[model samples]
Target: MCLAVPGKIISIHDDGSLMKMGQVRFGGIVKEVNLAYVPSVQVGEYVIVHVGFAISILNEEEAQKVFSYLQEIADEGGQ
Candidate 1:
C-alpha cells in the first residue's frame, strides 16, 4: 500500500518554472516537495505528502494525530 506522510512546510519558493516547491520536515528528516496542488498553503502549515507532492493541507491537531499513529507503527516494529 502507498503511504502518505504528514509534514510541516518549512519554506516555499518558485522553481523558476513557476511551479511551487517547498522544504518539508518529517520528524528529523527534511525533503523538497512539490506544492503546486496546495496553492494557498503557507510555511508552518502541515501537509499530507504523497510521492514528493503535497496533496492536502492539515490542521495542527490532525497532524499531531497522524504523528501519533506513525509513532505507534514505528514502536511496534522496533519491538
Candidate 2:
C-alpha cells in the first residue's frame, strides 16, 4: 500500500526554477521534498508528503494526529 506522511517544513530553496523544494522533517529524519503542489506553503508549516513530494498543506493539529497514528502503527508492528 502507498502511504503519505506528515512532516514539518524546515526550509525552502528557490533555485530559480518553477519546481519549489524544501527540507521536511518527519519524526527525526529530514528529507528534501518537492513543494510544487503546495505553492503557498511556508517554513514551520506542516505538509503531507508522498514519494518526495508535498501533496497538501495541513494545520499543526491535523499533523499531530497523523503522527500519533503512525506511532501507534509502529508500536503494534514491534509486538
Cα shift from native, residue 49, model 1 (Å) = 0.5
lDDT digits (tens) for residues 2-79 of candidate 1: 799999999999765647899999999999999999988999999999999999999767547865997889999999
- TM-score for predicted model 1 compared with the true structure: 0.69
User: Residue by residue across 1-79, what tens digits does model 2's lDDT show?
Assistant: 3699999999999776778899999999999999988988999999999988999998767647865997899999999
Q: Give candidate 1 misplaced runs (Cα > 4 Å).
A: 15-18, 61-79
Q: Each prediction's Cα lDDT score?
A: 0.90, 0.90
C-alpha TM-scores of all predictions: 0.69, 0.71
Candidate 2 runs further than 4 Å off:
60-79
Lowest-scoring 10 consecutive residues by lDDT in candidate 1?
59-68
Model 1 error, position 23 (Å): 0.2
